[model samples]
Target: MSNSRSTKLHVAMFPWFAFGHITPYLHLSNNLAERGHRVSFLLPKGAQAKITPGAETASDVPFPLHGHLCIAFDQTQDQVQTILSSLKPDFIFFDFSLWMPALAHQIGSKAIYYSVITPVAQALKVPTKQKLEDMTLEDFMQLPPGYPSPSVRIKSKAFEIAQLKVVAEDLGTGMSIYVRITSSMIWSDAMAFRTYHEVEGPYCDYLRKHYAKPVLLTGPVLPETLATKLDEKWTNWLCNFKQGTVVYCAFGSQNKLQKDQFQELLLGFKLCRQPFLVALSTPDGCATIEEAFPEGFQESVKGRGWVYGGWVPQTLILEHPSIGCSVTHCGYGSMWESLFSDCQIVCVPYLGDQILGARLMVEELKVAVEVEREDNGWISKESLSKAIISVMDKDSEIAGLVKYNHAKLKEELTSEGMQERYLDTFIQNLQGLLD
Candidate 1:
C-alpha cells in the first residue's frame, strides 16, 4: 500500500460507443464519485448531448474509418495521452479496446482493464474470434479446444450464431476479439470483470491461471437504488393485470428483428394468451405503428396486449408485481435486472455474448430456458409459446425450478455489501499501486 495517508484519488473512465458499454462505465463512475473520487467520463463528441453533462469527448473519427482498428489505436492514444496530461489522474479505467493499455503506459498512467461483458464470455470469445468470422453454426456450436469452462454447455441455433458473427465482423476496433482481449491481458496493470465468484468461480480461476495477473472481481455493479415511481400511463396499464400474470418482452436497444421474426414474436405472444407488453424498435422510415407492426396484428390482440415503439423503463416494469416473466435478448443488463427483480427469464439471444449468457442461464444456473427453433433456426410461435408457458405457469415443474433459481440469485445479488465489497477492494488496490 502507498505510504500516502490519503485514500482519495482521481480516476478517469473511457468506454466504447455502445449503450451496453457506456451504461456500465457510468455506473462505475457513479460509484467511484459517491466514494469521493473525482472522475472524468469521456465519450464521442456527438454523444455528449445525449447524456448528462460532465462528459469529456474526443472527436468522432468518422465511421468505416472509426471501425478501423488502427484508427482507434491512433485516436485513443492521442486523446487519452491528452486527457492524462491535462487531468494527471492517479488511475484510469478503460473499456475492452486493446490499444488502451499501451496508451496508458505511454502516458504514465496506471490502467485497469474493465470488461463490460462477462468474464466467461471474454475467455470464450477471445480464442474463437478468428474462426468465428468464418465458421458455420454447426462448427461454432462445437466449442473451441481451449474454451475455459466445460460446465457451460455451449448451445444456440445456426441463424442466431450467424447473427453474432456478423456483429463481430462489423466491430470498429482494428483487432479481432482475440487480439483485443489478449492484448489487454498482456499490457494492463490489472483486469476487472463485471461478475462475481459465486456465479462463475471456475472460469474466474481459469482466467487467473492463464493470465498470471491480478484479476479483480467487480461483482454485478448494479444501481444502488431502483425507480420508486413509474410513468402514470404505465402504472395505470399495469394495474389491470393480476400479480405474476404478465409477460414482459423487450429485445434491448440494439437488437433489430427481421419482419418475419417480429411477426412470429407477436403471434407467440398472442398464442400464449398471456397479457403482455412488447417493446420493439420502429426502424427509420417506418411512419406509423401500423406500418411497423405486422398487418392487422395490432387489431388481433387489442385488449390483451400493449406494444411500445421505443424507450421503456424496464426496471420499473420488472418491479411491478404484475410482471412474472421476461422474454428478452439475454443482454447482460437485462439478465442482471431480471435476477434482481426475481423475474423468470425466457431468452431469445440475438448476437455476441448473448448466446453464451443464455446458455449459462439455462444450463449452469438452471434459472432460464431458451426458445426452441426449427431445423433451419427459424423461431416458431409454437416453440415460443411452450417456453413462455413453461416459465409462467405457476404449477408447472419448470416454473418451480425457475422461481427457486430466481430467489437464490436475488438473495446473492442483494446480500448486504456485495456491491460495496467489490468497489472497496478495487479502490484499495488502486491506492496500493501508488507505493
Candidate 2:
C-alpha cells in the first residue's frame, strides 16, 4: 500500500495482434507504470500503428511480425527472444502463442501468461495440444463436469475455423488455443487475467484446480477515464432523440457480417423504430458497403438511421443518455464497455468466446437478451427484431430488470479499491516469482 514498500518490476508485455488483446495489455502497462514499475510493451510494427488514439505508443519495440494471422505469430518467436535478451526484464508477460515460457527459459527470464478472455473461456480451453488436435464438434457438446450449463453449450454449426482460431488452431496450423493457454499453465511463472473473483470465482477456482498454478486477476482492467469526446455531428444528431430512445449497435472491429445478415440487422433496427446509430466494419474477404448496402435502405430510414462504415468512439455513444440498448458481438472489451454504461444488451454474438459471453450475459448475469437463432444457429431478422422490441419496450418488466442489473454491476465495477486490490495481488505475485 505504501509507495516505499512497493516492489518495482521491470515488466515486458506482448499481446496477440488485435484491438481487443492490445487495449487491455496497454491498460495493465499503464497501471504498472503508474505504480513505479518499469514496463516495455512489445508489439508488432503493424499493431503499433493501430494503437488507439490518445494511448501512449512511444515504446522500444519496433520490429514487425510480418505476414497474416498465424503466420505472423510464427514469425515473432525469434524476434521476441531477441527482445527478452535485450531488455532483460524481471518477468515477461506474453500472449499464449509462442511457448513463451520456453523462450524465457532460454533467456533466464520468467514468463507470465496474460489472458484477455473470460474465466469460463480459460476453464473450457482444451488442456493439451493432443486433445485440441483430436477435438470434434461433439466433444465440444460434451461439457466437462461442473462446467456451467447452457452458457457453455456452443451451437454445433458455430464450430468452424474462425472459432478454432480463438481456441488456438490457427489456419489449420500453428499451436492450438489449448497449447497457447495451457503452455502458460505449465511453463509460465504465473498467470494474469482481466477479471475479478467476485464475477467468476467458481470458474477461477475450477481453473486453478485443473491447471495447478497461481491464477491472478486484474479486476476488469477498466479504463480510468472515458475521455474521448463524441464528434459534434454525432452529438448534435443524438440531441434530437428523447432520453433512452436510441439503439446503439456495433459488432466490434473484427466480426463482419455477410450482406444478407447485414440486411437483416437493418430491417430489425427499422422494426424497432428507435432512432439508431449502427457502425460496421467490412471483414477481410467480405464485400464492401457499396456492394452490400440494400437499395433505398438508407433513403427509407433517412431521418432515423445513421450508419457509420468505420470506427466510432463507442464508449462516448454508449454513455449518452439517448442510448437505451446495444446490440454487440460480446467481445470482452465491448461487453464491459456496454455494461459500464448501463445499456441493455441485445446480444448477437458472432464468434466463439462471444457465444459463451453472450450466453453468460443473458442466462447468468440477466443483464442482456439473446437474439433467437435457427436450430442450426443462423440469426434471423425476426429474432433480431423480437429481441430489440423486448429490450426497448419502456413498460416491459424485462427491460426494467436488465437496467437494474446493469446499474448494480456498474457500481461494483467502479467501486474504489476493487481494481486496485487486484492489482496489488498481481504485483505481489510477481514479487513472489522473483523471490
Candidate 3:
C-alpha cells in the first residue's frame, strides 16, 4: 500500500461529452480533491463551463500525459500512452471509450472506469447468438403492424451464444492488461437507489461474486447541473411548476426521432389533457418542427405545455414534486435519476443502452411502462395515448403499490444502516491505498 502520508495521487478524470458523463466525473474529481488528492478533469474545451464556478481547476490543465493530453480525438490505443507520459498521474478514472488493455500496456497506470448505471444490466445486453447485426431494409421498414418489438421475433433472437462469447472475451482480455475495474452497481453505490434486493439482489450478487469489482456507488450526484445565466433562467421556469404536477419529458440528446414520432408524442400529450413540459430537438430530416405538427395542434396545447428546443435540467426537474412522472428515452442517467427519485417512469428508449434500461424498468422495476415502438421506430399516437392514460388516470391499486414500493426504497435511501456501511466502505478503500 502507498503510504497514506507519503503518497498523494494526481488523478485525472476523462468523461464523455454528454451531461451524464460530465457531471459525475466532476463530482468524483471534487470528492478526490476534497480528500486531498490533486485532480484535473480532461474534457473537450466547450465543456469547461460545465465545471462549477469557484471550483478548483488546474492552470496547467492541458499537459502531455502520453504525448499531449488531447481529449477530443476518437479514443484510440496511442492516445492513452501520450497521456501517461505527460501527466503520469497515480490513476486515471474514465467514464467512456475506455479501451483498458491498450491503456494499461501503453502506460502502467491504474486506469479505472466508472459505470454510471447497472453494469449487470449491461452484461445482460451482451448479444446472444442468433442476433443479427442489422435488419435488412425490409425488416427495418416494417411497422410492428400489431405488437411490441420484444414480443416479435427480431429483437428477442438477437445475440447468439457465439456473439456473447466474443463480446465477453473482448472485455476479459482488457482486464488481463489492467486491474479490471473497481466499481459498478450504481444504486447500491448510491444511497439514492431505492431498489428492493429481493428483485435485483440476484443481479447485485452476480456482480459481487463473478465480476469481483467492488460495487462503489456514491449517492446520486444531483445533475442539478448548470452552465451560465441562460441555464439559471431555464431553471427558473422549472421552479414555477408545482411539485409532482408536471409531466417532465425529454428524449436524451442522442436519440433524435423522425418527425412522425415527435408529432405522435405531441398529439398524445395533447390528448391526455395533462400539463406537460417537453425538451426536444427537431426530428430527423427536419430543420424545424413547424411542418410536423398536426393542424391547430400547437395552438391547442399552447398554454398547457412548454416545449423547449434544447436541453432541460433533467436531474433537478425530476426531483421536483411538481414533476410527477417522466417520459424518457430511457438513457442510463435518466433511468438512475428516476429510480433514485422513486418517481414514475415512462420509457420510450430509442436505442442501445436505452433499450437495455427499458427492459429492466418494464420487466423488473415495475415502476414504469413502455411506449410502443413500431419497427419503423415511430411511436404511434395510440400507443402514446394509451401509456399516458395508464400512468395519468391511475387507479387506487397502482398508486398504492407505487407508493409502497417507493417508500421501501426511500427507506433504503435514508437508512443510516445502509449509509454508514457504504460510506465506511468508501473511506476504507481510500484508507487501503494508504495501508
Candidate 4:
C-alpha cells in the first residue's frame, strides 16, 4: 500500500452501547477531528444524551440487558446504512455490530474493527480456527494456540470459567458473542486497537499473524488535557486528608456487586484504616448503596469513609494529591488511568477481559496487585484488605517495587510526542487502506 500524506479522510463511528466502548470511540473521533479529518459519530439517543450533561446515560441499563441492547443495535442497520449512504464516509469504525462490514461495503466505505479492549484479552478468548460452539470447558481452561503471553491464562476457578462461557454463549441474539466479534474481525478491511506496541506488542503481533491483515495501534487515546476539574464536593473532602493517605475505589458504571460482596469490600476498606472514597452502583436487589451497607457500617467508619452511588469525576480524583491508592475493576480504561496515575494499584476484576487485564498488570507488568478470590469468585474482606496493604504500606517491598516499575513505564508512555506519533501513524495507515 502506498503512503499518501496529503489526503484527508472522512470517518464515521458506531460503537457498542456500553460507556466503555462509546467513550473511547468519542476520544478517537476527537483525535481524528483535531487532525483535520471530517467525522460523523452515530449512536442511540440515550448514549448521545449521556455524553452530554443532564441526561441519563445508557449505562443505567443493567448489565444483563446488554444483549437486548445489541438486538436493538442490529435493528438500526437500515437506518445506519441510510446515514452512511447520505454521508458517504470513507471509513466506518465499529466494535460490536457484526453486520457493519457488509453495510460499509454496500456504501463503498471501508469497515475498521476498532477494538477498545486490550489485544491480549481478545487473543486469549477469541478462537482462531476451532468453531466457537465446539469450545469445551477444558478448552476454556487452557490458553488459545499461539497466545502471546504464557503468564496470562484463564484462572481455573469455576466462576472464572463460567464467565468465559457466558462470553462465548448467545446473548439473546441468535449469534453467539464469539461469532459476533470474530466474524466482524474477519470481514473488516482493517483492524485497530487502543493500545501501544511498547505495552502489548507481542499480543498485537499475534493478532496480526492470525488475522492476516493490517493491525494499527492508536496508543492509549487519552485526552491531551482534561477540560474539567474536580467537583467541589470531592475536592473539599479529599483536601481534608493528607497527601498519599487516601484510597479511592470505583468499579466502572456497569458492575453491580452482590450485596454480600459489596459489604465485604466496604469492610475491607474499613480494615485498611485509610481515608477512603467509594463510588459504586447499588448492589443487586438493593435500592441504594446505603441499603446495601453492612449493619452499623456507617457508624463504625463514619469519619474515615464515604460511599456514594452515582457518577463521579474519576479522572480528576486520580489526579488529586491525597489519593495515594486506587482500587479498580481493571476495565481497559481504568487500567490505563491507574497506570498513568501516581497511585498504588489494586485490582478486583469481575469479567473475563478484566481478568486478563489484571493478570497483565499484576503478573506481566508488575505495576499492580490483584485481590485474591475464593473458589466461587467471592472476594473476601481480608483478601481485599491484604492487597491494599501490600501496596499502601510505607515499608512494604512490594509497594516500593511496583511504584518504581510503574513510574518507569509511565514516563515512557507519556513522553512528549509519543501519543501524537501513534495517532499520526494510525491515520497514515488508515489512508493506506484506501490505496
Q: Write candidate 4's Cα lDDT for 131-238 as tens digits.
A: 655543335434445554635343435665566566776779887777888899999998999998999888888889879998999998986546788889889888
Worst 10 residues of 2 by lDDT: 58-67
Task: Name the weakest run of 10 consecutive residues (lDDT summed) in model 4.
Answer: 49-58
Q: Of 2 and 4, which scores higher on TM-score?
A: 4
Superposed model 2: Cα runs more than 4 Å off:
1-5, 52-68, 125-147, 150-170, 283-291
lDDT, residue 404, model 4: 95
In candidate 2, which residue pairs clash?
167-177, 168-176, 168-177
TM-score order of candidates, top first: 4, 2, 1, 3
The lDDT-based order of candidates, best leading, equals 4, 2, 1, 3
TM-score for candidate 4, please give it.
0.93
Local accuracy of candidate 1 as per-residue lDDT tens digits, 1-435: 432224788888877666677888888888888877789887766566766222222222322343453444446667667777788677778865566777676667788888887666665532355565455433334434554342423344466456555435545554555465667777888888878788877667777766777788777787754536788999898889899888999987666666777778889999999999988875435665457677787888887799888688898889889888899888888888877886889998766567777777887788898897675667888999999999988789988997898798879878998888877887777777777
lDDT of each: 0.73, 0.74, 0.54, 0.84
Q: Show the lowest summed lDDT stretch of 10 residues, model 1.
A: 53-62
Which prediction has the highest lDDT against the true structure?
4
Tell how far residue 149 is off in model 1, in angstroms: 3.0
**Tens-digit lDDT track of model 3 for 93-180:** 6644445424643564555556555443333432224334443212221222331222212233232222223223333233310122
Per-candidate Cα RMSD to the true structure, in Å, reads: 4.1, 4.5, 9.1, 3.1
Q: Quick one: RMSD of model 1?
A: 4.1
Which predicted model would earn the best TM-score?
4
TM-score of each: 0.87, 0.88, 0.70, 0.93
